[model samples]
Structure formats: structure tokens, C-alpha cells
Target: MASHLYGNYFSTRSQRVLFTLEELEYPYEWHSKDFARGEHKALPYVSEHHPFGKVPAFQDDHVKLFESRAICRYLVARKPGHLTPPFAGTSSASLVQGARFEQAASVEQSYFEPPLEKLGFELIFKK
Candidate 1:
């Protein structure tokens, strides 16, 4: 199955998704947009793919996905058993496994990320 990633070098969120794809050995076409020119803010790219006109919009056979984190999750779910085991939706044991994964992910998002993100914004992006 072919997939496309729309992004540019400057977006850290885009890089995150790109890194995950590389780590998973998932082959995809990369479509670079001119961020300086605000090309991503235009139509079709924004309206058809990403509602927010964000960089790192992803499209595959099944769906078009926006948001860097969601794109990463999709890549993992699409090809499980490589880096991560498949989320078995039909079994209770697997459901518990999913819950635990969610818990850890929640901890990272709720606790670990906020301070780090703030620091990153102040130190890196807010120049």
C-alpha cells in the first residue's frame, strides 16, 4: 500500500512522524511544501487533507490523517508486530494490554510533556 506524507524540514512535528516512519521501515512518498511561502495554508492541501492546514498531513489507502501524533499511531497500527505488538481488540487480555499502554501514554502526555514542551517552546521556537 502506498502512503504520502506532506511536510517540510522546519516542522518538528513533521520530523517526528518522519522519524517514526523511518524507524518502522515503512515506505512512503514525501511531499514537501514551502513553509516560508505558506503553501500549506492554501486549498486542497488544507481543505481536503488537513482541516487546520498543518504540516505533516498523511494519506494512505484507507484514510487521510492530520495531527502528527495521530499519524504516528496510524503508522504503528497499520503495521503492528514490528516495533509493537498488534492491539487485539477482540480479546480481554489484549484489552488490558491496550489499557496499560494508554495509561503510560497518558502519563507521558499529562505529566512528562507539559514542562518539556514549555521549555522547548521557550528555548527553541520562541526566539
Candidate 2:
């Protein structure tokens, strides 16, 4: 059993996950959740795996995990050859990099959300 990646295709976090997986050269199954179809709202599909009904969930062997950054860090640590610090066991660089990326991504979203939603409402929804 390798792993499974569940996310909306082209999502920023999802892209990051895919990039990290590719960098690590890990073999995994990918399931693209459709946003337009409201696939993420399905309880049976999410409750079994995700408590928050979110995308970018991961499953490997008997363990299941969520959160894009966490998954990326796990991949980098476990598969050092992929996007990890050169001195894996002796260095904290990879961990630091993962943390930095997470912070930046979160910040970008928080900064963009208000303006984005307002634009969509005024331009698309005519509100």
C-alpha cells in the first residue's frame, strides 16, 4: 500500500502536495475532488476520512492524515531524496522550510480572501 492524495485539481495546496510528492519521487494514488459538484460536502465520504470535510487528505497503510503542509513535510522527511535537506538526520533545514512554506501560504490566502470575495461578488454575482 503506497499512499492516496485527495484534493481539488489545480488548488494551491493541492499543487504543493503534488509537487512535494513528485520531488520525493513517491508513488501514490490521487483522487481529484470536484468543487463544482459539491463532492467535499458528502458526509459518508468525508466522515470516514476527514472530520472537517476538507480536501488534500492522505492515507497510507493503516495511518491517515490531513493538511497539505503536514503531508508535504512527512514526504520530505520520509523520502529525503525528494525536497529534503541534504543532511536529513543532522539538519533542521527541511523542517524549517516546511514551516516557512505553510506560513507563507496561509498569509497569502488571508491577505487575498477579502479582496477576492469582494471582487467576485461585485463582478460576478453583481452584489
TM-score of each: 0.80, 0.67
Candidate 1 wrong stretches, greater than 4 Å? 86-93
Clashes of each: 0, 0
lDDT, candidate 2, 1-127, per-residue tens: 8799988875666887898888777899998888878777687658866778888888878878888778887887777663654432325887777677677768866887668867877787663
| Decoy 2 TM-score against native | 0.67
Per-residue lDDT of 1-127 in model 1, one digit per residue for the tens? 8899999987878999999999988999999989778889988788888888888899998799998888998888878857675577769999998898899988987898789988999999889
Model 1 is weakest, by summed lDDT over 10 consecutive residues, at 81-90
lDDT of each: 0.87, 0.77
Model 2 alpha-carbon drift over 4 Å, by segment: 86-127
Cα RMSD for candidates in order: 2.4, 4.8
What TM-score does candidate 1 get on C-alpha atoms?
A: 0.80
